[model samples]
Target: MPSANQAQAKVQKLRDQMAQMQASTVEQIAQLKAEAQRKYEELQLQFKTEVAAREVEVTRKYDELQLQLQNIMKMFQQSQNRSS
Candidate 1:
């Protein structure tokens, strides 16, 4: 019942709508990728910060243990000298 020109115009309109939908989908994908990259970088920075803090704590504990060992050795030496 429709004229040939009218049918062609309807097809063109549907094609234009499809193109617009594709463009919108592509834009959304790009935005999601950018957000994911930003979050990954933030997590990496947090992990490095935590690792550095742990390293400092471990170094402090080692130093304290070394000092305690040195004090014990000195006491032993003093006792030996008194016996001699």
Candidate 2:
């Protein structure tokens, strides 16, 4: 059987190990949260950039379609004038 002093020392050692593990877990959690935040911000920026690029492209395409329609109308007017 172990002596009382030896039992007490063993108990103290176990307590110290538990405390160290708890501290390490807390630190790991903090690091993971920071990394997650950084990734979220980066993705948000990329999404905004893509949205802006798409908006510009859509606007350009709309303008081109409008111009083509106008040209067709003018051609129709010219043909009518020739017929008259």
Candidate 3:
């Protein structure tokens, strides 16, 4: 049978191991949170960049369509003047 001192020593060792495991778990959680935040910011920036690019493209298309419409109106007016 183990003596009281031996039992106490075993208990202390177990306690130390448990404490180390807890500390390691806490550190890992902190690291994961930091990584998640970095990824979120990266994705947000990418989304904003894509949105800005699309806005510019849409504006360019709108301008092109407006110019085409104006050209058609001018051609129709010219035809009417020739008829008159």
Candidate 4:
């Protein structure tokens, strides 16, 4: 049978191993959280950039349509004046 001292030593070793494993698990969890946060920020920035680009394209198209409408109105007025 093992002596009391040997049993106590084995118990202490097991405790130390458990503590080390817990620390390692905590560190890994922290690393994963940091990675997730970085990815989220990156996606947010990309989304904003895409939205801004789309807004610019839409505004450009709107301005072009306005200019065409103006031209059409002027041409129609001239045609009416010539017919009068």
RMSD of each: 1.4, 1.3, 1.0, 1.3
Q: Give one digit per residue, the lDDT tens place, for model 4 in 1-84.
A: 999999999999999999999999999999999999999999999999999999999999999999999999999999999999
Supply candidate 4's per-residue lDDT for 31.
100
- Compare candidates 3 and 4 on TM-score and give the better one: 3
* TM-score of each predicted structure versus truth: 0.87, 0.87, 0.92, 0.88
Candidate lDDT scores, in order, read: 1.00, 1.00, 1.00, 1.00
**lDDT of candidate 4 vs native?**
1.00
Clashes of each: 0, 0, 0, 0
Candidate 2: tens digits of C-alpha lDDT, residues 1-84:
999999999999999999999999999999999999999999999999999999999999999999999999999999999999
lDDT by residue (1-84, candidate 3, tens digit) is 999999999999999999999999999999999999999999999999999999999999999999999999999999999999
Model number with the top TM-score? 3
Off by over 4 Å in 2: none
In model 4, which regions exceed 4 Å deviation? none
Model 2 global lDDT (CA atoms, 0 to 1): 1.00
Question: Compared with the true structure, what per-residue lDDT tens digits does model 1 show for residues 28-83?
Answer: 99999999999999999999999999999999999999999999999999999999
Candidate 3, residue 7: lDDT: 100
